[model samples]
Target: MTKPESAEQDHGYDVVISGASLAGSAAAILLARRGVRVALLERRSDPDAYKVLCTHSITANAYPVLDELGLIPAVEKTGAPHNDARWHTRWGWIEPKAAPRGPELPHAYNIRRSTLDPMIRSLAARTPGVDLLLGHQVTGLVREAGRTVGVRASAPQGEREIRAGLVVGADGKDSAVAKYAGVPTQRHENTRFGYLAHFRNLPLDGGIGQTWFLEPDMAYAFPNDDGVTVLAVLPDKKHLPAFREDLEGSFLSFIRALPEAPPIDGAERISKIIGTVDYPLISREPTAPGVALIGDAALTSDPLWGVGCGWALQSAQWLAEAVAPAATGRGDLDRSLALYARTHRRRLRGHQFLAVDYAKARPFNPGERLMFSAAARDASMARHMHLFASRLIGPMRFLSPVALAKATAVNIRHRGTAASARPRTHSEP
Candidate 1:
């Protein structure tokens, strides 16, 4: 860990990043690769600080960035590869007919944050020109003439101000950097909470993730390494009292009540049930003059899709690529930051919109019903749906008029055939 030098000391750096988690650490590594000096500040004293209330599932889309950062092997050691998904609804189990066999760009990884955060932190500390500062709590942003210049932080040694060319907010959803930078955020209350825990000795099939859609309530289980399974239940707000009374019992009951969910009744618990009442929040803008926001600090999506970690890593990579040249004095900083803002919106707006709408607890819209039903009936449709869900394909590909029409036709034909196959009753006696 980097020690906090006195304010008078010459500790010049090109960038100062707050919140030394996934986004912050990734940004530091990327910038350092470009030969830019970076100061990475973390509030937690423990260098191994990980987000306890996270799903910690990295999607297929995030693998390229991890590979680029040379973290694939490290993460693979701690994670299990996840590909297939099983959705249990009133209609029955909608599992992929076969494993998605194709040119695997990067499948998802089921990892626990406890193992991931420390690994990335160590990597950042070893990267040249990167200063990893643990146990430093940022008090506020330093602005000069309306431009973010650096950050004011309090460490065990004492209070200090660190100046830099640019400031990056990689903090989580409730980011102090965003607040002090005066960036406004838009939050939608879904009136739901999530209870999550890990279990051992569970008979969970590897290579697949499971999601039980119990209409207003939902439960999902992901098989992780070391014969552990991560299970979560998203319940409506009306059931808060039951959960508040006995967290473990209520969570277990919720999972057991789900139709076709694996029998977790006999499974041994590996961790205590933890609950997060506020799980959904979306920010309006991710960047400003001289400062940029990454990860949950910029925008938050519902955990139902398990894209938080992927988005965090992706956002960090995007910001680093956008700002590296400028930080190294090869381009205009304002132009670089502006381009980053636009690119961020272009990449995430559609997905975030869909996630926010779904977080409302509304039933699948006509388009969604068509797609899901088609995927349920046709293996080809399932592959396409899987690609889209994994973020390999853009949303436009799934929402195209041709794709929607085909899905609608398939769903209608399936229902029609089922109706025709039913037995008829006699009219006369």
Candidate 2:
């Protein structure tokens, strides 16, 4: 794809992207690759803006997108390879090895947000036909005849108006673009709070990320490129106060209490503890006439699975592909935005629905119990669980009758064997 020629004047661009984070920058790169001019706006002046409160684990499914954008080599230089997943549950530790997939579909990558975000933003700036605007915060959307045409932004230079045929909202969970564009959003009340920090000297199994399902409360530790590791805890709302009082101490204690805890006991803290309270996972329709939303701005899934970064990049790619022809004047902008909206909803709604349902803090449903129990007992079941976790299969596949029946049979047989091995109880005289 050839790069588009830049507009001679500075008042407008082919597309105006609000928020220069992962999603926005990725969209800019994709648009530029397809010969579409883009103006990427970010509130922060620094090019190296970082999202401090993220786990930054990109699943294997996202690797193809990164490779297609020519970013895998650059990202791999700063990120650690993540290939295996170790689940610590009441039953036992279930380790799922990476499937023997080709290099195109390798395992996961664990890169700190501090490093990953900046790298992608820099690439966006360097891409031809992309105008990277920093330190500019958008305050309002410009509408022409009831359709979005541009944005009203405020920067140190003063207020300015930049017009574009298409406007994309990549601002984030508390997105101003969605609000100004009048896209209705429904929020699920997630009472879970998360606390995370980086540490050194933590003993982690090489190349594997570990998650402890401490029923009700969950903890995860992922090793990154540098000697640093990210440890996060998702605690019930009631226990939030203790975490707030002593952030570092409480975070360590929570992880240590897990059944097969990560070796944080001898670890030295490398960063200040960060906490998000009552962070509900939210989902919203991502488009309107001449406007669209991507990433967290579109749908906020539960962070428990570490899917935010991957989903953000993936959605950005989807939006860029869907809107390219319209931005180039070959197709209608409204139709393009509508198609992008439908595609986003179709790809994400089912996944988000199931995630939000499980976020309700209820005990595992029968299907979940059966699947996990089977994974604990058999390697093949573990591989199936991995495929589901990595999102290679849809929810329907995971919940299919055949899969459920196999899991149920495994669970029942195991229970029967345990029951037969137990000594019989006798009545006392």
lDDT of 1 at 8: 35
lDDT of 2 by residue, 295-380 (tens): 99999888888888888888888988888988989888778878888888876787888889878766666667678878887776
| Candidate maximizing TM-score | 1
Lowest lDDT sum, 10 consecutive residues, model 1, at 1-10
Query: Residue 256's C-alpha lDDT in candidate 2?
Result: 81
Tens-digit lDDT track for model 1 on 81-157?
A: 56457776555566555445655433768888888888888999999989888888889888999899999998877
lDDT of 1: 0.81
- Output the TM-score of candidate 1: 0.94
Residue 45 in model 2: lDDT = 82
